[model samples]
Target: LRELKTKIACTIGPSSGDRGTISELINAGCRIFRINFSHGNLELWKEWTDNLRQVSSSLGVDCVLIADLRGRSIRFASPIDAKTYSAGQTFYIVRHDGREGEVPSVDSPEFFEAVSENDVLVSDDGRGLMRVLKRETDKIMVQALSKLTVRRGKSLVIRNKEIPIPNYLSHCVDQILDAVRLGTDYLGLSFVTSPRDILAVREFLDKNGSDIGLIAKIETISAVANVEEIAKVSDAVLVARGDLGMHFPLEEVPRLQERIVGTVTAIGKPVIVATQLLGSMISESVPSRSEIVDVMNCVVDGVDVLMLTGETAIGSYPVETVNWLRRIIETYEGDVRTRREISQDQLVDRFALGVVELAEALNAKIGIYTKRGNTARRISRFKPRTQVFAASNDPKTICRLMMLWGVEPIHVDSKEYDRGLEELEQKLKEQNLVKRGDTLILTYGLLDKPIHTIRIVQLIS
Candidate 1:
């Protein structure tokens, strides 16, 4: 299989959680596996993580695990029979307090307190819309604006409204420690409204002495409004278009996606564009023409990663879904140009840009020796056109580098930078990844230092 610059992330579920299926997925070019906490227990998550690790080791591929925490997103408290509502029909949204009532309800008291009369509630990505008519002590009466069905555990959001993040996120500490115990490299924070949400989690992680990176999900209007601040605090940002459609008009989703992508990329952080990239392929064997175009557009937009949610989690053709996505990414990746120039006043940022400019001018591939992956990330922010290889001795750093654009992570055992680069070059040569007469721009530096060294080397027969 050919290496792809734009990485693919697959959500693990019953359809693709087995060792054999995971091996197939790794061979099919999935480097990041997402374990969603909303659906599975710790036992199941451990099983999935074990299978992924074993399969990846057997296949000699390094993969990263993401613990997708179920943040403050509101959902039905319990299973309820699906009920269809007609336009202008009255429905009661009751708080789940063991009360016997034939109404859709949520278990969160904050949600009930935050909602008011005339507020609009949407579910299933705006498929169902309800306007709040009146508020009682424990329930709210709403009028249906469209004909739709209400199902159990369906996510509902107050349209265009931002709910406050509680002083403490319920169960977040336990979830963070659970993820650390499971050896996850990144935490995917859902429904993030501002930088404070990320900082609060970061503070908790630091207190516990965990260095797991954070990827803030930009799905709320408030999140989009404060994206710059959020991106500054986050290690990465995710453009969650599915729930974003619920918080904003459908027509504005595409524009919002572009804006979020641009903002996150400019901040020198990895940005992911997710949700419904290939929605049709969940059941069908082939992707729709529009879906293919959408994938290509993401590549053109300079997105670091394109993620698959339902397309791989519950979809019948998980392996083929990854195969098609890989093909789409590889097909358009060569034509991608840097969308914009990111200007930074830091010496490291200017040095990275100069290295990229030199590599481009000489038509040479770039190689870096990094201990904490900061140099690799700085170079990645420039959107280098040539192939870039980042070698590190730290396993965590290598896994985290998998999320960056155009970066191929290599793991070496050497503690010294010089030896690490030698090992990296040998591996590249043994794998035929680089050939004789190919040019390489080798570079490395200390993150704390104001100076870096660059070298031009040509492979010899």
Candidate 2:
């Protein structure tokens, strides 16, 4: 099997939640499993995480678990039977209170207040489009612009509007702490609008003494406007094209994706392109040709990861979806020689750049011994053509490094730098990652010392 450079993230749900199915997904090249808190309760999430960890250990795969927080997003509070509306059909939406009502309702009072006459409401990421004809205190009359099926817990957004909802992180503090206790490697914060949003979560995690990485999902115009600062505060960035389409015109989504990916990449953080990468594969066996081109384009654009939301979460062919994604990413990496020109003024970043430059010039595989995975991330920011093998003594760091582009994370038992380097090289040779007579460049850092070391060596039998 060919190794993929661009990582694949699979969202865990009923369709692919079991241990056997998760094992198949890992084999199909999914390294990160996203547990969406919007859909399941804590009990269900615990089951999924337990199964995932067992399967990963059994398969000897270092998988990363992301607890995706449903932050301040509006959704249907009560279960609504699937209802279909045709174009030009009229309907009513009201605030979902305890009282029973005939009209469909949402859980957000802010959503009702922010909407007005002529304002458009979108559900399920543009599947359901309705225009507000009139509004009362708690109810709004809407006309469907296109045919759509409404279901329970479906997310709703006001087109081109940012609702003033309460802080979801504050509301879900217990859930976040529970996820941290469940050994989640990362936290995916949804609907983040500014760096302060990320900082709030970071502060909470710090207070709890958790080192979980934060992924900022850029889905709104405000987030796009503050993407640079957001990316700087975040451990990674996810370009949520689904909500972006709802917030902006469909025609501008591609440009927005490119701009966000470029900005995140330049900041030296992992950038993930998500939502509808393989939407057709939700029910179909094969992805559409355009989906193939879209994945290729993301690869060419130098994205660190490609994420599947509904495609794997609720799709019929979850494993096969991952298999196809892996194939597409591998094919693109083999045929393309794209590079991102990144400039960093920081001393560590400059040192990492020098390491990448040396490896490229020598046409050698790069080996890094990172304690917190910072060295690997800094090197990845340069987008080197040669392979990168990042070894970390910390298991969490090993799993977190899986999100970086072109990085193959390996866990070493040794904590000392010299021993860790030797163990990494031995494991690389044993796995046939490096063979005799091959040139290898090694690097590591010392926190106590101000300087980092880099050396080139030739493997010998």
Error of 2 at 353 (Å): 2.1
Please provide, for model 2 over 83-112, each residue's C-alpha lDDT reduced to its tens digit, 9 standing for 90 to 100.
788999998887888755446888777887
Tens digits of lDDT, candidate 1, 408-455? 988888888778788888888887878999998888887577668888
Which RMSD values do the candidates have, in order? Answer: 2.0, 1.7
lDDT of 1: 0.87
Each model's lDDT: 0.87, 0.87
Error of 2 at 374 (Å): 1.0
How many residue pairs clash in all the candidates, one count each? 0, 0
Error of 1 at 171 (Å): 4.9
Candidate 2: stretches off by over 4 Å: 99-102, 166-168, 335-344
